[model samples]
Target: MAIALNTLVEEAERYLNASRIQDYCPNGLQVEGRPQVSRIVSGVTASQALLDAAVEAEADVVLVHHGYFWKGEDPRVVGMKQRRLKTLLSHDISLLAYHLPLDVHPEVGNNVQLARQLDIVVEGPLDPENPRTVGLVGSLVEPMTASDFARKVRIVLGREPLLVEGPQMIRRVGWCTGGGQSYIDQAIAAGVDLYLTGEASEQTFHSARENGISFIAAGHHATERYGIQALGDYLARRFALEHLFIDCPNPV
Candidate 1:
């Protein structure tokens, strides 16, 4: 039996606490689809290929980490936007996305997932004052060398981590999932031995050298893929819906 689109949206809204947060794009139902949803397809980004895969799979909804209508993005829906929307509308497939909300959610968030994978016990948010802060600070259950931690991250994530080694043993570590190099300062302020995130900017090299805090830039797409995968699995169990995670490799 298929669940109502409204029901699924409501579930997502509640699970993510979507209403309380300001996001880049609308959190749920960016495009309306059929009233009933039996199958869902998820991806890291709502790219053209992903949309096509969802349509082919007969998915009622396509859930993603990144959707359209970003802040300061072009409002005009002309070229890429027009095509993406057209396909969904034509097939009556809904598009639902959760950005930072998904990134920071305590249970299924990117940071927490990465922590779980790397065996880190998350104490709390890296930025204590902001609930929306995507980074987290915590200690390992058993302290290990920075190199060892980096190896664990690489093996668990199946990607080479960009490591800027600082101290001998890394007890306190701070991490954010995707493209979070900007939060290096936040991690340093939290007094962590190592800071781990997805991508790095050119300036990040300088930040590492000057701040004396170890930095790691794991692959953006690789680190981010886990959270939404967890989210999709959760939805599948809770809703008894058929869900598939579409993997599209991205080096960046």
Candidate 2:
């Protein structure tokens, strides 16, 4: 089955509530391809490798969590950016991306998906007063040592997480996926036993040590890989179209 490009974009935007969230990049269709769509290729980032794979797959749309045109970036179309745009334009493959919306959605969000993967029972937002906070607070089924919890993260994420072992066991936890080390302070304020994010800053170690909370920096790509796939699956099931996820692995 096939649906109109406009219809699919509208439905996705509505489902994710994309317009309501302010993000660094544009949240909807970044590139126009064909008028009708039947197959989609999904990925974490719309890198050249993913685009090449989508072309090989004969995809009508290339759906991704990361897309082109961010704020403060040089708007001039040249170099790597030009090459990427040219590929999409030449192949007539649409690019649909969702940033903050995909991160914060209740059901298919990165945060919720990660929590489920780690067996954490979600309590609420990390910052209850802030509606736009992307991090979440949750609790494990049973308390475990900081090292033990890091091992679990490694098993679940298929990557070794950098852990700053603190004095507390991991029961109450806080996490924000993908370059969210800045939220460690917020997690500490919430009185969580552990805080996890995709990447960590130099200051993150000090903060966790001082606050007596365990901290882990799992790979950013590893953490964000699930939400885009889930979104693609939802779209494919909704429209009865074929969907494929092509992962371009990033160690960072």
lDDT tens readout by residue for model 1, 65-108: 98888889888989999999999999999999999889989999
Provide TM-scores for the models: 0.94, 0.98
lDDT of model number 2: 0.93
- 107 in model 1: Cα distance from truth in Å? 0.9
| Clashing residue pairs, backbone N/CA/C < 3 A, model 1 | none
Error of 1 at 47 (Å): 0.7
Tell me how far the alpha carbon of residue 173 in candidate 1 is from the true structure, in angstroms, after superposition: 0.6
Cα-based RMSD of candidate 1: 1.5
Off by over 4 Å in 2: none
C-alpha lDDT score of every prediction, in listed order: 0.88, 0.93
